[model samples]
Target: MFESLHQTQVIPDFDEDEVMLEDIEVEELHPTSTETEKNEWKKRKTRVRSDVWQEYTKVMVKEGDLPVERPKAKCNRCSRRIAADPNKHGTSPLWKYYTSCVKKHEANKSQTVLNSDESGSMINWKFNQDRYDCVKMYLTRKMHLRIFSVFPPAMCGTHLNLVVERGLEEIGMLVRRVREAVKWIMASPARSEAFKDTAKLYKVETSKFLCMDVPTRWNSTYLMLESALPYAPVMALFEIVNSAFVRDLKQKTHNKKSIGVPEELDWHEVRRKCGYLKKFHKLTEEVSATSYPTCHTFFKEMCSIFTVIRRMEGHEDEDIKRMSTRMKS
Candidate 1:
């Protein structure tokens, strides 16, 4: 295991006047050099603090009798020196040079990703668990370097789904009954066609064609409910018409548990629960429409979800109130 900061070996460009070197004592080597001469090359204060600084050392040269700092940044991994005038060009040259060095070093070592366009180049360097553990063990625990991690704001679809999942439990019975009813109708091509005929018979326009929910995503559950709710009357009549098929399903290979149809009470519960869920579904659609969504939009949607759930906490129904309160917690 490597202990100290890692450095790479790079070849120097003979054409350039700049070269890589470590600190050297002028007085010890050249007794004629005075203390005042040594003090002349005192290291200048770095105006900007950057991680790139860790890789390169400033070359100190002697002009006759005095040691002077050169306007150059040298790569530790290689002898290549870059022209770095902080006052004039800032650290731009140093950053660009380091980026190239990283690219070459990573490629030579068969490491994946990392190389340009300023900060964009650093995006691909995968900092997985091993690197994370090393930072914690050597840096933080050893107190050698203080590292602060800046995390991006949490507003992904995963976060939204997680937030909605608990609230869904409140109306699990209603969801299950509706899911079962939809599942029965959509079980086979024959049954699906029959359901479409029934929808026409009742003149109920099923938008998603009896789409069901995937267990992982709650938006699908909301969609499943959205499509199924409009066909409440259709489902009731269809269930009665196909009672024998449903009975046979239970006796045969289908789920042995009672695939109960959504009753009036279940439908009522679904309607009430859908009020908050619709907000999530709409926001989900808006967010999904764009490949990249702004954090401001996510912030507004998050606040909207919070408001809906908070309002539900004060709902007249005790079950809704309890569910909302639990979800808020």
Candidate 2:
């Protein structure tokens, strides 16, 4: 048996602690020409835009906007081309320069007025800076800002206004109920305490009291609904506890106005309406931002609004569909 067995060296077994595993180096195989071509196409297909202009260009059409001159990028608002090559200008410098150009254009336009003669020839009537400044200063000193009230238009062919007004109309009953609930709680200290007690009873957290909404200000009404929704359960309980008070109040106002006490369904409606209106609310906030030019985004925003309205048209919820239809009108 020993002679038949092949001669072999005896291997000693090392302890587990003495054995160390070295990291294996991985080698990447060289890609074939076909794969390389495929990879190049994939990179092009999945290319991500890192610059603001690249992202903006997707939503912006070259039509209606000024075209950039060769070797430089032009701003849409001011039509100012970059002094240097846009590729080397980078993000910050390019955007800053463009905004500065817009401001400069705006300043020039403010001081410039057009005058026409009988022959229909036009001349640029420039205002004196000193005179303009003096007039502005005098107006600021003499005019009372409080007396000059600015009432924003409700419907001015804008999508924001369309949605907001329709949503408000749909939830008009719910709004009145919320307004009445707020009045009920605030009219008496006892009712207010009872309202807080009910919230405490239900272990509900409230950060603030219900806010009042101005009749003309729909934004404030949305805010009131937002604040009131959280305390809906508490308000419902308070209404039950003071049912007699509510009934007597209703009877007193029977001829003047109907103070409908909000029930569970009414509160739920308020919550739903708030959720529906939130999109318009957010749109308003975005468009009203003072930091950047919103006019450029008008077309994009209107498209988005129409898209939302179209989606809501087929919504499973009847209220949403109804609101969307009303907005369409």
Candidate 3:
């Protein structure tokens, strides 16, 4: 009975609740670790796909050695194949097809000539007072020709002939007719009023008193002067003549109307206007010095000014006629 020394120890049971309640803090500083790993995997997959695609593209290019089929172009009218080269044909599809049509259109175009019913009127005559003065000087002084040479032969003879032919009084009737035309043209709403007025006035006075018709006689006079001078002097003389004519017309009109006021009436007015006059004079002087080039430049400027003025005044028909007349004369 004394041999059995058995020790009875109490077995401690482990509590799950106590273990769960224990503060077991996990230090997870990198919270996106799983997401980062997923992104790296995706990148690797993308790289492999890109490499495969590039290799496929290279293989395709090497095998083909040509581009895909291009769109075909054909002419609508002829139903023919049209070339794509712009230099050989034209840029637009329509342009290449319409080339022959355009040429045909141009070929079919007609020439138009302006017509006027007004009698005793010469076309393209301008009142260049300066030109008139120069022509007068050239005729009377340089060429030793009478003013009669500068003017058309006495319409007196023509009038007498017409009177005889038509049985009409020639003397005062012609003058009266011309004067009426002058007044009518002066009062006209046309841009040609200036030119017509000057021409009519010249016809009236010159024909009535001097038995001359300079307006109709300018071409002959110009030719005679041209024939007499060297080319350079001829051009200079022409400009001078033209300028004098314009100046004369202006002067005569002023004198006739008794508008004797000087352009610079007041001192202040002169000062204000001087700047423009100075500029004009400077340009004129420069042109005058240059001779032929100046003439060409002036003529070009004049045509441009005339064009603008015509457009503004709505006198395209009159302007065209006047320009053509000038060229012909």
Candidate 4:
């Protein structure tokens, strides 16, 4: 047992003759300067490209940006050459232009939509949980007032519907043609200016600018017709001045369902329609007053509207009676 313990304590040694010495080469690990620079350049290019692409998408969604859909780097408005990395797809410049365009569009839209917000109730108001009930009460009353003024509870829903929507629907094709004519007139600034010049030549005084009616807003149609009625004689004068142009338009659109220039009868019909919609237009304006609460006047205003329609239903004019009958249905 003592010999076994001594043997365990002894260290095993290799014979010097079996051990051989040789030179072993060690490789140095140094980063390549050129490769590092290339990596940095790649990173910078990727970051710039990503930023540019973000800008491009924003511009694409904005209104009034030309080539808004899948636009290239060239600016549609300014016709300027956008800068981009030559080695890359060079799409960043275009994207940058697009982003700038969208920002401009948003700024314009905000200006138009919120022009009256400065005078609104919330102009200088602060919001807090402590005043939650007060705010709720204010909103509820304001909403109720607006609703009653626009649509009085005493008036039948169908009555409002018949005047606003059903009447327009009854004359579907005629409304469509009028809409098309207005669209054509307002298609370009040149066309609009020409129309105004024609009005001047005919010595016709137009009170308002030509307006395009919004299809969803029937009141807008009435407003459009009202603005257009006085210009009928001027349009006739324009047709005479540019008879060849009108003839060409007629020839080109003879086979196609194109929006044609208004004829004398079309103008007369527009005037007649405007006369028919005078009461509706007045009522719409009265009810849509935002600065003043109109609920108190809803009863009187609605009664007047009903009385006019009732009288029209038995009018001597065949067209007026027919229109009233359609509204009744």
* Best prediction by lDDT: 1
Scanning candidate 3 in windows of ten residues, the lowest lDDT window is 52-61
Off by over 4 Å in 1: 1-156, 245-259, 287-292
After the best TM-score superposition of candidate 2, give how far the Cα of residue 192 lies from its true spot, in angstroms: 2.8
What does each candidate score in C-alpha RMSD?
Answer: 27.5, 26.0, 27.3, 21.2
Candidate 4 pairs with clashing backbones: 56-95, 59-98
Against the hidden reference, what TM-scores do the models get?
Answer: 0.50, 0.48, 0.14, 0.46
Write one digit per residue (lDDT tens) for candidate 2, span 18-121: 44332122212555688889988888733434564631232222332576434444565656555333356555656676555634444443585555876667
* Candidate maximizing TM-score: 1
Residue lDDT tens for model 3, 202-316: 3432222112223333222222222221222222233343464324334443214522112212223223323222333334444446334565565443334234423434544
* Model 3 backbone overlap count: 20
Q: Show where candidate 3 strays beyond 4 Å.
A: 1-68, 74-172, 175-329
TM-score of 3: 0.14
lDDT of 4 by residue, 1-329 (tens): 88876775567996764443211211124456887898898888333435444333222222255633332344444545454434564664565566666333444424744443656543655668768877656655667445444444555433564565666665554566556656666888887888778788667665687789888777777777777777767766766776654664454342256545676776766676667677777777777788998889876878777777778878887766777777766
Minimum summed lDDT over a 10-residue window in model 2 is located at 146-155
Q: What is the model-wide C-alpha lDDT for candidate 1?
A: 0.71
Provide the lDDT at 328 for model 1.
56
